[model samples]
Target: MTIHTGHPFADPDPDPARRLRGRVVGAVTLWTAGDRADRTGLTVTSLMVALGPEPRVLALLDPDSDLLAGVRETGRAVVQVLTWGDRQLAEAFAGTAPAPGGPFRQAEFVATSYGPRLATTTTYADVSLVGEREVGWSVEVEATLDAIIVGDDADRPLLHRRGRFHTI
Candidate 1:
C-alpha cells in the first residue's frame, strides 16, 4: 500500500461537466428533515429559489442521502443558509470532515415544524415537498416555500467553489 498526498483527483482525464460545475459558485446551505431522534441533514450547494405568487425551491440532492429519505417520509424540510463561521458544520454534514458524535452534535439546532434548523442561522426556509425526479446523478427536488426568514445581508455568506469554501 502506498500513501499519496495532495489532490485526490490527479487523473489526467477529468469530466468537463464536473469541472464546469466546480466553477459555479453557490451559497452553502444545509437541508434537514425528520424528527429529532431520526433527523438527517446534508450540505447542499446546488440549489436555487424561484419567486412567484407561490415561491419555490429547487435543489439537487444525492439520491441515496438520508436527508432525502427523511424528506420523503415527512414531506417537509428546513433549508438554512450557512455563514462564514459555519464552514466546519458544512463540512461535517457534507461527510468530508470528522464529526466525532455525528454531524448534529457539531452545533446547536432548534426544532422546527419542518425539521431541525441551525440555531445560528438567521436565514432559513420551511418547505414542503412538491415533487422529485432523477436528474443526472442526483435527485432534483422541487419544494413549495411555505415560510421564509431573511437575515441581514451584511452577514458574510459561506460560498463553495472549486472544492473550497469562500466568503462574500
Candidate 2:
C-alpha cells in the first residue's frame, strides 16, 4: 500500500527488526572508588547521550545510592565501553558477580591514556564532571571528556539488550 504524507499512521512498518538490530545504548560501567574502594564501582544501564558533541554525557544515578554519593564527592568518573571479555567486571559491578572479600582479585587494572583502565579491556573515555541535574528520582550528571583508552585487538562491542549483555 502507498503511504500518504498527510494521513496519520499510514506508513506501514516494514522490517521493524532493522530499527532495533544494532541499536545500542550507553552501558557506562561506573567505577567508584573511595572509602570502601574495595567494594566500589557498579554497572549502570541508565546512561544516555545528551545530544551534541560538546563533550557532554549524561549518566543517571539513583540519588540515594552509594555510587551516586561517590560521584558527587569525587566529581569524576571513568566511563568504559564494555567488551564481551569484560562480562565478569560488568557483572561484578551489577552486584551479581561475587567479590571474595579483601582486595577483590577477580580483575586487574592498568593505566592508559585515560584514567585507571580495567584489565577486562574495554574501550573507555575518562570524564570529569561538568554539571548535574536532579529530576524526581534520578540524578543526571554531565561530564567533560578527559581521555580515551582503547581496548585490546578485538573490535566487537558489548551491548546491553533486554537487561543483559549481548554482542553487536
Q: What is each predicted model's overall lDDT from 0 to 1?
A: 0.96, 0.63
Candidate 2 backbone collisions, by pair: none
Over the stretch 1-168, how does candidate 2's per-residue lDDT look in tens digits?
976667674446645553463264545464543443423466766676554666566777777766667666766666767667777777777777776752235677654332345665556777777888896578887887676666575667666764568776
| Model 1 accuracy (lDDT, Cα) | 0.96
Quote each prediction's TM-score.
0.94, 0.67
Residue 11, candidate 1: alpha-carbon lDDT:
66
Candidate with the greatest TM-score versus the true structure: 1
Q: How high is the lDDT of residue 117 in model 1?
A: 92
- Model 1: per-residue Cα lDDT at residue 121: 90
Estimate, for each residue in 33-74, the C-alpha lDDT of model 1 and write its tens digit: 988889999999999999999999999999999999999999
Q: What is the C-alpha RMSD of each candidate to the true structure, in Å?
A: 2.2, 9.7
